[model samples]
Target: MSSAYNHARPPAGAASLPAPDDPVAARLQESARRMAGIAVFSGVVNVLMLSGSLYMLQVYDRVIPSRNVATLIGLSLMVLCAYLLQGYFDALRSRMLCRVATLFDAGLQEHIHTALATLPLRGAKPMLMQQPLRDLDQIRAFMSGMGPTAFLDMPWIPIFLIALFLFHPLIGFTALAGTVAIIAMTLLSERLSRGAAKTAMDLSAQRQVLADTTQRNAEVIRALGMLDRFTARWSRANERYLRENIRASDVSANLGSGAKVLRYVLQSGMLGLGAWLVVADKASGGVMIASSIMMGRALAPVEVALGTWKQLVAARQGIKRLREICKATAPPAAPPVELPRPSRELSVQNLSVVAPGMERPIVSNVSFALSAGMGLALLGASASGKTSLSKALVGIWQAASGVVRLDGGALDQWRNADLGRYIGYLPQDVALFDGTVAENICRFDETATSDAILKAARVAGVHDMILRLPDGYATRIGAGGMSLSAGQRQRVGLARAVFGDPFLVVLDEPNANLDTEGEQALTRAIQALRAAGSIVIVISHRPSALAALDMALVLYEGKAIAFGRRDEVFARVSNASRQIAERQAAAAPAVARRAAAFEGAAS
Candidate 1:
């Protein structure tokens, strides 16, 4: 939803293609039209491909026998010109295909990025999701390589066969039979290898996912002595992938070899047949060579196709997956309306959320309302639904039963980009991208001013700490902030959450990794946000982090146990705990007295 995208339109040539409801179909149609232009050049190139055979025939039948130097020279010049034209056409075709690839990427890159960003909300595993960009690269590489050229040359096979018939019917028949046999072999290769190739791709994806997951938690794996176990699991997966890849490659290689041998035999057979015809006064020696040459030309594409079958199959599969992903994540028919900025009145009515693949709701029947200049603390034990409710409020997780609204409008009613500008969220796990400290504090917005970034850093009380880094705001962080300690990363994320003075701020476990100084800064930031008429919601298990909040909500077993003024909810929880403890103390004495009486009676 960037402003630059708001008024963007497709290129003029794309207008001729059918603009179907499916964007993927439309893109493919446009691409095909562009490829059609390249196909025209391919036709010219293939025609020129026959020049070599014709030149040989001219030299043997006319120039050599007549001993005409002028005729030979003329033929040589014409053949040279033909070869040059063929090269030009081939180069043009390659250029056109590259252009098409560039255009295809330009058309789909944004959609793919949007899908990747939104998929996690729908419970997608980031590692398991197919990478459209990589798939796009596969398609482009195939288009610009021999794979597509083989397909383009396939249609010219019959033309070569006709030329062979012109030489002699027997030679033509031999070539035709060779063509059929090669075609059959190509089909066999596809049949034998497709299943294994697909399995290889799937296993490769799984291996990549495992590798990524383990690397992301390298500390835990190393500390717990899980490296050997992980390595064995990875080795097994890699072996399976390798096995499938070898199976597919073996099938393709055998077919390719068979095709080569068949072509050689067929060419030699045509020559022998032509020789017999010449002896029988049915054909000429010049025609024999010409027929063999034409026959070989016809089979060359088949050989190339067989050799590149694996790439072709893989590209086809990649395209299919990309299409499916595009369809699944297509934008809505009508864009959501962009509403005016909210005044930070947050409300949740009977909200419920069930985690992916779980039958029970993680957060159920939770309700709350907070106005501008007010703050709410979400207090709960582990697995008590505090983080789930926080996610629901921020529109990161959809509620199953009810609604979360800002300024009387449901969260879904607002365009994500517009709504995001006024909302800030700090998740339980603080992940900062690899960039400068200022970039992370400013949420990596290119247009953010230095003043805005410094202000947020000050608000989060990390300004002095950042200044102490090697290069201050310009210091580079490693992937996931590996260059910084946990406390530093948490502080930076806190600054990001409050950056831009958002109207609604939600921080989940913000103090989990913070020291005393960081904790105090967080309390002051909450108070400052509330004073600025921003509604702040903090989710924490530590009571110290809740001191500055105006109200509190206690969640127990996915249900709201209490919600009201902060002191009131705290008092209720404290009283409940006191009553339970007293009852336990009274029952302990009675049980001890009973045990004593029973022992005395027995004695």
Candidate 2:
């Protein structure tokens, strides 16, 4: 579980890849364009405000000669222009910002979903994906508060300052100084935000752990009457999250306050200096007023830029992660040569698999051949490489040294999509989505319509169960299909694997949750597949189940301890059944006690 959230650092230099076409970058770009337009409009609005005030002052001073009709008309037009410019820019910025936010949310959700689908199988890793989703929510909240000004207007701050300098070097230089100070303040805020980001990530992982713990031990917690204890644990997690948030906010608030104060002071000081210049006739009154207004306008973007400072950090992380995913090595590409069409006969020679990191081979010097209409059973204890062997055979896990030949060509010569189309797989842990019963039964393949779905369900012997539900095939299954009992879920999963009429099918621990009737249905289905000349492979430890298999292999400590016809393997392990039964008898009381305890807790 700890390893799952340990944020595996990309190998050295892998993090330097260019940003991909992610939603965040798209939002930033759109925001940039909108901010550019708004900045121009804002500049025009500021110019009008400055011009209007100066015109009224000129009239009072008799420079333009006070005129009731002309002056009122000119002022009315100026007021209208200012209102129009300000309103237009404000509305434009609001709409653009909303669009950016929506894009951000959509992209984040899509990336999370894609990552879940693409992540490699890592045994026993408690999933940390839920944390990223939570962080994205926080990011959305922060983005909404800052508005388009934070990111979009940022690039314009320097340009506006330069424009002010062109208007008057003195005003521009002073604004530049203020800009530097604002940047320093933002840097401080950013440093403080680092702590917040780390804390937020940690809290998110911790929250997941707590949630899983509560779920896994729900029965225990309830039986022990420890709901209050669990609640306290959750309350503590929330408090820590709150404290970290407050610390981040305190830093940001101080930085904002300081920037605002410094801007005001700089403007006031500029005014005082401009006043001296005006009295000395070195600068005109209009220029002075214009400089004062422009001074503040120049600083406006700087402050907004500072406010969006945290986003830069988050964006960098997001892009780096996106790059890592894009650059992930996919399963080796298929060879240019085409493979023979899949046939009933499958064979492997000198097979050896050494997974990416580990030193030793998981399965070595293994060889076997299965003919059409034949079924083989694999019996092994957990961690004995039985699953790995199955994966290697299906090309999910590559063999380091060997040939996996289906029909008469190398497995690598066959396209993955084509192979998948002809092969059906049922992993030990059945994964179902939050969809209707029919959808799950069809495995979300649109081609499997009502008739096809019902047919598959009938074959798996779960059709009657579906009819028992109020909504029948349309009944909504909760996440992971928790709504269905274990046996029912397994049957549904089996129905899915067998739905597409594949040439070959693989079932991993298919009988794990099946009752006597369910087991019989599976046996009958396997026999039917054999009759259709389709090969079937089953992985399990039940001796009773081996009677249906044409051949069997017994594995121990990652080695094939025995292999042959069912009679031959049984002759070698005739005592194996008695040994298994005795072991179960010894463990029964403890399991029964735990079950009782769990039920009591839940009640």
TM-score per model over all chains: 0.92, 0.77
Tens digit of per-residue lDDT, candidate 2, span 487-583: 8889888888777676778889888998898898888778777777778889986644555788887777767888888778877777777888899
lDDT tens per residue, model 1, 528-603 = 8898899999998787788899898899999999999999988999999999999999999999999999999999
Give RMSD to native, each candidate.
3.8, 9.7
Candidate 1 achieves a global lDDT of 0.85
Task: State the displacement of the C-alpha of residue 38, model 1, in Å, after optimal TM-score superposition.
Answer: 0.7
- lDDT (Cα, 0-100) at 104 in candidate 1: 66
What is candidate 2's TM-score against the reference? 0.77
Q: Please give the clash total of every predicted structure, in order.
A: 0, 3
